[model samples]
Target chain A: MKSRVIEIVNKTGLHTRPGNLFVKEAKQFESEIWVKKGEEQFNAKSLLKLMKVGVSRGDKIEIICEGPDEDKALDSLCELIASLEE
Target chain B: MNLKDYLFEYNTISLQAEANSWQSAVKLGTDLLVEAGTVEPRYYDAIIESTLKLGPYYILAPGMAMPHARPEGGVIRTGYSLVTLKTPVAFGDVDNDPIDILITMAAKDTETQNKSAIVQVVSLLDSEERVQWLKTAKNQEDLKRIFESLTDFE
Candidate 1:
């Protein structure tokens, strides 16, 4: 398994559009991707689950990936999180 | 209060309703709220004006929408009304377009409006399976059963 803890940098954080984008990114991987906010973890591919995380700006979240292509999944997702803009 | 409580109290579910446009669909929900005395008639106009400015930001997902303005938009009380369209209506949102479910909400204050009402409704409609079940629901009992099952709503 591979994981990375990243801070939400986007002004709006993950809601509608960004949440949808993040879910789209996660679905391209074969790994089982999950996002952890505090102790709560949700399936990264589910848009509603991602929104339910309520990731506001400056909040730290962990992206965990296991199974085939975990490393690539981790890198791609971290970059997506990092690239999130207003 | 939770969605189930608001829904039951208001008795505000209109299933298989016809709407020629997004605004009309929203009107269906607000009309019920007006009749229930949850919000003033001006509240409906406020919602329409906000949507015109913000686009369809309320389209929560592919098939659902939750239309609302700020509390000061003319809220008399905090309440919600739901309208499920017989045919989907497009609100020009590329992703969450062709909305079939419209849920209008009025809150006494912005702080209370920012609470878990939207989240709880999203939880109820999160899955495609649940959304499909809701779309196929034939009566108020079916809708009530679904809302009642979510006891953990906060």
Candidate 2:
């Protein structure tokens, strides 16, 4: 298992577009990835699940990855979140 | 329960080539409300403020954006407006932006009827050809053609 926590930085937060992007990216990795915000945990690859959590800007979210490519999966997602712009 | 009855062809845009972001996107919708006489001019600011606080949520599936505000935020009645961005602007969601088609909706309540309208609109948008036609449509007649054709599909 590999995990990292990052605060959402985009001005509009993880509304729809970025949320979908994150989901699309997570689906590519052969790992089980989940995004945690508050008490809610969502499958990182499901756009609907991500939207339901309604992650906003400055919210701290935990990304958990498990599988053979867990390390690479976590790293790529961290990079993606870090690169988000308004 | 058809979208055509609820949606009309908004030919004139009061915002007029000025909107640039998610904020402006809501403004475009409210501007249509004013033109349609559904709400007051000041209502535009109210919708923008609320959506900024609550949204930027691009929930229109693939290439569309259904920008809306909750009914408590001064929605006069259940209403719908359409705005085609002259150039798309990012709503912060990559798969969704920069959005070229924005359908601003307001409902009287979360009634099944309203939900059905939303579903119908979403279904219309989900169609790739309809979305494509909406994207390339340049005038009211063109938009009307696309929207009217949706009824036949149902």
Candidate 3:
């Protein structure tokens, strides 16, 4: 498994539109991606679970990817979160 | 404020409602919010406009959706409207389509109050059995009982 901790750059974090984009990006990878915020960790590919976490701006999250493409998945998801715009 | 409190106070739930299409289904839910004064008429327009730009952003599952516009889209206060359609309508979302339950939410801003609604609603529908039972709510009293019976996200 590969993991990276990063701060949410978008003003709205991963809520709504940004959240949708995050899920869409996660689905493209063959690796299993999970987002961890504090005590809660949710499937990065599922929008409902992601929205349930209600990630906000300035929040720090850990992205974990495990599978054949774990390394690529981790880098891509982290970059996506860091580059997200409100 | 709690979700049940807002629902009871605003009286914004419509069960077994009718809508010919996805847009109308959204209108049905947003109209209830408008009547309750939780959001202005423009809020509905904003939802439609946003949907046009972005696909339905709140299709939680195959049979349910929790639609809401951004807070800047004329939200008067944080509130929610529940509308269950008599006939399910497709929202062009191939993954989660033919939605029958609409939990339309309006937030004045991204405060704890609005976030509470998201957590509460997600908590209320935690199970497939729960979602099926929610579709069985035929009246306000039934919904009240259902809401009271919910134990999660307290």
Candidate 4:
């Protein structure tokens, strides 16, 4: 498994359009991607699951990817979160 | 934020309803909250504007769509409106299209208390069987029983 820890930089965190974009981007990968916040983890591919976790601004979450393209999945997800603008 | 309590309190559960278009479906859902004083009239407008700009991004699953807008977009209180259409309508979404159930949310903030409402919906919709169960509900009692049946909701 490949994983990376990143902080949500967007002012609104991961909700609304940003949340949709994150899930859509995660679905592009063949790997199983999960976002872990503290003790809780949510499926990165499901928009509702990710939103249910209630990600907010400045929250640090770990993106864990496990599959054939785990490395690519981790990098893309990390970049996606880092690049979100409000 | 009890999903069952919040939905039933405002009498927001609408089952076997009819709407010709996705916008009407959204109006029906948002109006429930509007009448109950959970939100202002502009809340529905906000939802429509966002859907138009974002293209039905609220359509979360195969038959379910949890429509919501930002808290400042005329939300007087944090609540939800549950609407189940008699016939599904297309929301211009290619993947999770033709939404049948819409749980419209109006939250005050990003706190866990508010987000737990979302978790309850996700819990009930986590399985296809549950999705079908909610979609085919005949009445308000059926809807209440369905929410009660979900033991995982907390």
Candidate 5:
């Protein structure tokens, strides 16, 4: 299991649209990815779970990747969160 | 397609509950469905479950929440209900805090088309000014004006 904490840089946070995008992207990988804010942890592939976390702009969140391609999943997700705009 | 026909004014709501979480918002939405006669009292659980499982994602953009479930999950018909939160609730990480507007949508099919009326109504919600006006609407007449404006779009 590999995990890293990343700060949300998207101005609108990870709302429906971006959350959908993230979920869509996460499903591409064979590894299992999860995201957490504080005590709340949710499946990165579930749009509903992602929105439930209510990630907002400037909030710090932790991404956990566990699977065969853990490293690639972590790096890709971190990149996505870091590059989100509007 | 006219939204005024499907839009019902539900004044009976508990604006006090902090819908800051997904569970609360689904509860509020289910209550409205029961009030609208669209679902049986027992269906409340189903609505909540589906929302958590499938979700009514908070695409509210600002201060609105469009809570919806897939069509096959016991959606008897296509209907809409509006619920106003007294203190607003947060849906995960959306920027709009305390969602004041709750638009509950239930369709017969997930990929159903010819939803021009509903689409028009949803499009209006994208406008910040309209959403603000909806927040302050005092009565059904006031609410009607909002839907009435959709005629221009048609």
Candidate 6:
């Protein structure tokens, strides 16, 4: 598995629109991806679960990816999280 | 304020309507908000304008869309309106297009209240079973019961 910890820098954080975009990006990879905040973890493809996690700006999140595309998934998702705006 | 409180106070449920486009579908919900005095006439224009600017970023799922704009768009108070369409309309969203449910929300530039309302609505929309139940429910009382029952899920 490959993983990285990133901060949510977007003003709204991982709420409705950002969460939806995250899930959409996560769905593009075949790797099993999970997002973790504090003690809770959720499947990165599930928008509802991501929203339920209630991550906010400045909150740190850990993304873990496993499978054939783990490294690529980790890299892409890290960039996505870092670049999230609006 | 709570979901039930807002619904009861505003009677903001409109069912089985036809909309020619996504903008009109949103109009169904914004109309209720306008009626409740939660927002001014321009709030509807803001929502449509933003939709044009932002794409259908508000389309939350396959058949549900939460139409809203920032508080500065003439929000008189924090309120919400639920509009269930008789026919689903496409919003050019790839993942969550052909929306049949429009829930318009307004807030007064406050974070906590807006967050609570969004969270509550997201929870309610998360359940496919519940959303389907909502789409098919017979009357306003049914909608009231469904909204009230959200307390149990919490």
Q: How much native contact recovery, as a fraction, does model 2 achieve? A: 0.13
Give candidate 1's iRMS in Å, 1 decimal: 2.9
Better structure of 5 and 6 per DockQ: 6
What lDDT tens digits, residue by residue, belong to model 2 across residues B54-144?
Answer: 4555445554676655555566666677677777777766555677777776665544213343555566675578878877787767867
Q: Which of candidates 4 and 6 reaches a greater DockQ?
A: 6
True contacts kept of each: 0.23, 0.13, 0.42, 0.42, 0.06, 0.35
Worst 10 residues of 2 chain B by lDDT: B9-18
Candidate 1 residue lDDT tens string, B1-154: 6676778787888999999998899999999999989888988899889778756656667878888877788899888887888999998877678999877878787445544555666777776776886787667999877766655543
Superposing all C-alpha atoms, what RMSD in Å does each candidate have to the true structure? 4.1, 8.3, 1.9, 2.1, 12.2, 1.9
The Cα local distance difference test for each model comes to 0.80, 0.67, 0.84, 0.82, 0.64, 0.82
Interface residue Cα RMSD of candidate 6 after superposition:
2.1
Task: Please write out the lDDT profile of model 4 over residues B1-154, one tens digit for every residue.
Answer: 4667888887988888899999999999889999989889999899899888877877777778888887878888888888888889999877778889898888776563235656666666777877788888998878878777877664
What RMSD does model 1 have?
4.1
B24 Cα displacement, candidate 3 (Å)? 0.3
User: Least lDDT summed over 10 consecutive residues: which range in candidate 1 chain B?
Assistant: B110-119
What are the per-model DockQ values?
A: 0.26, 0.11, 0.53, 0.51, 0.06, 0.53
Candidate 3 accuracy as TM-score: 0.91
TM-score of 4: 0.89
Counted clashes in each candidate structure = 0, 3, 0, 0, 9, 0
Give candidate 6 regions above 4 Å deviation.
B148-151
Q: For candidate 4, please provide the TM-score of chain A on its own.
A: 0.95
lDDT of 5: 0.64
**Candidate 6 colliding pairs, count:** 0
Better-scoring candidate (TM-score), 3 or 5: 3
lDDT score of residue A7 within candidate 2: 92
In candidate 6, what are the lDDT values of residues A1-86, reduced to their tens digit?
99989998989888766776788889899999999999999899877677666878889999999999999999988888888877
TM-score of each model, paired residue for residue: 0.73, 0.58, 0.91, 0.89, 0.54, 0.92
